[model samples]
Target: MDEKTGEVLGRVVVTQRVGWCADLVSTMARSLISEHWNTSDVGMLASGEDAEGRALPSNAWMALRRLGWGASAPEGVKVNDRIVRMAQEQAGRTLRSAQWRAELTTGVLTSWPADPAKRTADEWVNVRAAVPGGQHLPSSVIKSRTQQIASFARANGRVPADPFELEGAPGVARMLLLSACDGQQATIECREDDPSRVVLRLQLPVRPDPR
Candidate 1:
């Protein structure tokens, strides 16, 4: 049974009276990602574990639903399956992207420098080896990470145990990950009036007032 919507994932199929809208899709994706990121839910999702330490499903959306972090459509705006699917696709992509940073933070924590200001050649190699894909990463990236960790240590008087403890959660950009979404969420087609022109349409979530 699906915990979020209280519906069976495979058995029940409800038809939508209206088609999905690109604007609405964009709105929902933005809202879901923003909500997750702001609440540190993104970090939890990236960790692939709940407070109980149980392993979560590899799929981001499923993990979210399992954690009861599932999102909903905008109030007064009805959404269809395709719309929800698209939002899920965008959220999944964002969550997956965070895994890299999580691994990087863990690597840095495991290979903490004797001196953040100066990492010896051997220290450099150790840190690189500890991190996944660290060999290809630029020196600036690791240096920046070390600086962050150093700052945390200075303020707290103790090194953070992990990414969650170090940064709580990573922030995500507020844009639709259109490339990550399925064709049902967005599409591109040539304009009939002008062959040179093309139309790229996708959905977006609504944002509350800045105030």
Candidate 2:
């Protein structure tokens, strides 16, 4: 309740159909992420190149298509174009997310802790300083990177030389990231006729935006 305006502030409970949409989106996102969030595909997407050395399209999905690594819907599931757009949208975001991990990996590799199990204060400072935004990165992220390096050393003879050699890419959460967009890429609505079913709208640019 707001005393100043005499207006009550409360939560409005929408139908559970919203929850269904969320689950549906999550399932779809996971499939797309699994298909595209890998080293070979993401590496090509990042480089924007094809096997023949020709430049790829600016659009992530088009770049993927040029490289013959584009994602596809499940077998026998005829999804509409909007769904494909959502997959493209999510793939772009996932590739961008990999960049941070790539930087973090390089920082950790360059300023590796003397002991992978633990880091001294100086080692921690050095690593954080080496990374672009390491100071703001969570300690857990660094720790996970350390653990991966240590594991690699245990299996191989030596520590990894770089992020690419260390690992393909870090795993990211499977999400549609509707909040990140301006409602153009995706939108949600409840169907008055069928309260149990909600409508999720997805619209993507036919061509990549020229920025």
Off by over 4 Å in 1: 1-69, 74-77, 168-188, 199-211
lDDT of 2 by residue, 1-211 (tens): 3334555534332223333333444455556666665556566666756889899876555555566654555454454444455555566667756766777877888998888888999999999998888899888999998899889989998887766677653443434455434465566788999989998664322222211
Off by over 4 Å in 2: 1-69, 118-122, 136-141, 160-211
Best-performing candidate as measured by lDDT: 1
Alpha-carbon deviation at 120 in model 1, angstroms: 2.2
Q: For each candidate, C-alpha RMSD in Å?
A: 11.1, 11.4
lDDT of 2 at 182: 47
Cα displacement (Å) at residue 17, model 1: 20
What overall lDDT goes with each candidate model?
0.67, 0.63
Q: Candidate 1, after superposition: displacement of residue 110 in Å?
A: 0.7
Query: What count of clashes does model 2 give?
Result: 0
Per TM-score, the best of the predicted structures is 1
